[model samples]
Target chain A: MQQTLEQKPPVSPKVSAPPMAPTFSIPEPAQMPVSADYKTVGVPLVENAKFAMRDVNVFYGEKQAVFNVNLDIGENEVIAMIGPSGCGKSTFLRCLNRMNDTIDICRVTGSIQLDGEEIYASKMDVVPLRARVGMVFQKPNPFPKSIYENVAYGPKIHGLASRRVDLDEIVETSLRRAGLWEEVKDRLDAPGTGLSGGQQQRLCIARTIAVSPEVILMDEPCSALDPIATAKIEELIAELSQNYTIAIVTHSMQQAARVSHRTAYFHLGKLIEVNDTQKVFTTPDHALTEAYITGRFG
Target chain B: MESSVLLPVLALLCALAFVAGRSRSLAVAGVGGMRILNSLPFYYGSLTAFWCALPSLAVVLIWSIFDGVIIENMVHALVPPAAVEAAGGNIGLVMNQVRNLAAGHLSADSVEPAIAAAADRLVALERINRWALTGVALSFALIGAILAWLKINPQLRARAKVEDIFRWTLLACASLAILTTIGIVMSVLFESMRFFSKVPVTEFLFGLEWSPQTAIRADQQGSSGSFGAVPLFAGTLLIAGIALLVAVPTGLMVAIYLTEYASPRMRNLIKPVLEILAGIPTVVYGFFAALTVAPVIRDMGVNLGLDEWLTISSESALAAGLVMGVMIIPFVSSLSDDVITAVPRSLKDGALGLGSTRSEVVKLVVIPAALPGIVGSVLLAASRAIGETMIVVMAAGLAANLTANPFDSVTTVTVQIVTLLVGDQEFESAKTLAAFALGLVLFVVTLGLNYFALYIVRKYREQYE
Candidate 1:
């Protein structure tokens, strides 16, 4: 049998050579070894917590996206979630304000509390809840109205201001807090979409803060901007963190280190590590976190 | 040679030129020298083919279009002056005799001798013209193929030349529609000019009465019919206004419900059902308007105790306008739904994330963004409503009545035009010519509305991107 096997003709490759010059070969990547029994390694809980989530599992149709995540975000703190693409960081942040409820196929089962009040209660309305916790998206989305109207839209709809001057004051104050009043004050009646990319994001932030939310969620708000625009947004975030609790999702580790107080590393929909930002960057507690920050594999 | 055989030969020659050009380039470049070529081998082949085909096809087209006129003029020159003098210097009649005798449509025994000689000359010139066309077209095709095929080389910019040809081809295709539109406008203008010559423009424009009666003899009654068009214009505006009132609100609500409120599964099932209304023929809608809606409206008015002043006529503007509104619903809702759906998801989410309810987001954010596009759709629907004729002719009466009341019997411009030109009538009569004048007015109005709609839609497109 060994002689017959050795005498068999060599099998040809299934794919023929391309018609042009042959391409250079690249070696295949080695398979990464990720153990299944890993747990959350670093400090997942915090003191004076503003948001407390326990055993959160998110699913779309039958496919589970986030698996049993437990985390806490403290008051007046900025926490950054970092991971490779499609690791459920954005999915976890959307669950805070029940924004996932808009998607018909998405289902979330967990206990999420904001200021010790259940957000996913049977009778809870998303309107008032969203007012208390506003969000800034990856892309700058301004209403196709005047610049002043962009800032005044929320106040007008929520009836926060009783008089026209009061509404004017609210718009001015929000724009001032967002650091965009100086650049856009003269063009109050110009269309909001006519602003530059960075200015538009600042306008979006001002639009968000008009409602006085306690916590602000930002999903890679600087991803669409240039480096100079990104620096301005980072400066804005640092100043805004003093007044409100913030949660940010980022693909850049340097951005996480620069702006966040705490950093959480997620892998394959699992919460791998959470700790102080300096410690998470310098000396991570989990092997996967070390591999990610050290650029071994992503 | 017959053109049927000549055309196929020209096509085959172009194909051969493509192959010859490719082979010549390959032979000059050698195996490894293809890397040094300016463009791909396929571009060279296309260059050769275009050069061979386009000039040959142009020659054939020009020949086909003007060949008869040139041959007829040559045959007319061959006719004797005595033949023309015998026919009272009527050249048209003399030419007709020549063409008939040449085709054996007339007998030469009864015809004049000079006309028979002209007929023989006519037949000979036509046969010779056919031969010249075949010979000249073939020589041009062959010379073009040879020149293009011999010019193929490694360093030739065949790709750029081919792209230049493509640019002109695309320009020709794009201008075809514009040219056709200009042709239509010019024809309508000239006919309306003729109509205005017979009747004064002031009487047609400012006269309030509109009775166009054609009297064949001198002693007939109503010989000179009145041509006032104010009542027709008023009736058109009344019907169109009512149609807009019915269509704008209902179609907008349907679009808002579909885009903002309905689920995807429900949208899929309902959108096609709505578009089915658009697919129904206008003639079908006309009968439906006449048989069903008219009687119901008349009865409702009678039952409400309105017999003399407020009573709806059996053929009233309200019935026609209401049905026309229903007929144009798909145009409004479909276009409005597209613009509303085009409102970015980020804008809607931005509003909702700021504590605004779903309805508030739609009302404040979505509607304001899509407003210009909605107006464009409404204007387009207005044009459709104005140009509509069958339903008005069936459900609305022909008697032109000037009133703002929808219950009164009225006639629109399109209905009047249709009534004036339906049967066998004297094309030279003022009554028949009035139809062309009304057609010109209707054309101008609809064209202006369409142009405004396009401008608005373009402005909306710039707002987003």
Candidate 2:
């Protein structure tokens, strides 16, 4: 690659690079302890990492989107995926839940396992898999429905509650988990669209939580929100990490630093590096990861 | 021939003035000077043509209005006062005879010698009047041309003046449409008021007994023509109700299939074919209803053991309403397809991402978001059904029976209005005037439906935005 670059005529100084190094030491995996701070006790430890992705590659027709990406999502832990635009972080995140199957031209290969069972196996049903791995989108898109009905929709469809009290309890618990019960409990009959953007986003989160998924995937969940709303969502994500494995794709470096325990950096369709959040930010092994974190290149 | 010659002379002068003005400006600042002007050279040309044509056209219009009256007065003065009085209200008849006599054709009726001489005198007077009008029109054109030439200067602000004229012209075009609607309403109101004067307003509006025959003599008539509009109104509502029942669900389902399930190739193929149903003239629909659908309905009625009173006919409301529903399916489906497709894709993705199936997302999110627009489309289609004439005229019978049964023969307001005004009839009679009354009622109903639909659509838009 270095000889090829030296032979080609350079158009601009920005295109030039030093010769590729022959030997560089790949860092050993670090064992970081989970934080002890929490509002509640007796939360279960993330066991054997709930979801494990290995060498996943995604293609949209002939154009490759995600290339040889690997990720391990621990149960009850928040892992944030951060990258610049078109970096395939979202593509890799979508592959874990089989959401990419919804797109007509997208073809995802390689293995994604949930609890050591292959999720992408031909015999596995996609609907139940989706129920186990729910998603929240970038913008707040609450159903044009009443608040009570929006939260109760999934529970009703899955037959999660047999009696009226059970259904009510499910709605209340989900809303409480999302930290929206206090603001919306009095007017549960009001249309969900009538709420503020942040409240609507929380309502959507509660709606997803009502299904009792094992993992929650958020795709830039705070991108469309104001600072205060983003803060509220970050606090909710911290709370949710105690019960569900969470994978968040975000553009804000500071947000990833604040919310995630494990950080994965992607560049140009490749997972350049993944490490403990503090180490990834303070001392990255890969030159691309260092440049991305230090704001030198994206 | 002289007026045609004068018009072109005025046109030529205007064209010359435009070239002169443009060239003079170009000469002042060299060849590229036109780019400096605010408007193009053609605006200046049209401006010159407008000024030249306007005042002369106004004078010509005024002359044409008064010319006939002035000539008739002069001819009348030529005759003696006693003779003119004797001609009396037969003056128009006498004038026609005089014109024939002046052309050397003998009158069909016997002509008195005095009338023949008076006709001869009128021919001389017409010849003199024609010469005077031509001379006056020419002088008016000449004066207008001179004034336009003087005003066509470099600093005349011709572009601004032309734009103002165009602005007023557009306003006049717009007002013409508004004024025409007002004129139609006033005409309907006047005729309806006349019918009401003959038959009391309360009886015409709400009376149960609707026989409208006024006895010409002590013993002149059979059954009287009824003026009670309740039967027709009820028939219209029943038919429209049946149409809505068939169209609303079917159209919405078709819209969902097209927007949500069908591939792009299927959508492109099916949408135009469905819309073609709307373009197939209502008369053709009427024929299908009367010839095809009605017989099938009658056979079905027989199989159901319906009595003679309830037996369907070749001209039954059921057939017409069903075909009309089919005719209006495109109206509902196309509108709904647009509204459904207009729903943000993000909303669909958000629902689907939460582990919801395609059907679930459609039912819970897409349909609710598009509900108001769908309601608006249905209401508009309902208005179309109520106002339809040709379909009901050919398929639905002329018997104005007040019944909810679709199999029974019925007459709607549009059908009755068509039957009342088919051939030559005295417009002054209550029978003819009743058509206007029916038309007025139909207009009011459809207008109200349209306004309500617009209101719903606007309100829903406010909610989402």
Candidate 2 Cα misplacement greater than 4 A, ranges: A1-47, A116-125, A161-168, A186-190, B2-14, B24-43, B56-158, B209-220, B459-465
The i-RMS of candidate 1 is 1.6
DockQ of each model vs. true complex? 0.52, 0.38
The Cα local distance difference test for each model comes to 0.89, 0.80
Worst 10 residues of 2 chain A by lDDT: A34-43
Chain B TM (all candidates): 0.89, 0.86
Best by lDDT: 1
Lowest lDDT sum, 10 consecutive residues, model 1 chain A, at: A25-34
- Give a tens-digit lDDT track for model 2, residues A92-210: 88887888887878998888899998988999877778889999988888877789988998888778999999999999999999999999999998888899999999999999999
Query: What digit string (tens of lDDT, one per residue) describes model 1 on residues B1-465?
Result: 765688888889888888887777777778776787788888888888888888888898899899999888888888888888988999999999998899999999989787898899998888888788888888888888889988888899989999999999999999999999999889878888988999998988888988888687979998888888888988898888888888988899899999989999999998999989999999899989889999998998888777767747898899999999999988999999998998999998899889889899889989888988899999999999999999999998998887877877899999999889888888788898899899898998898998988898788767644
What are the clashing pairs of model 1?
none
Per-model root-mean-square deviation over C-alphas: 5.8, 7.6
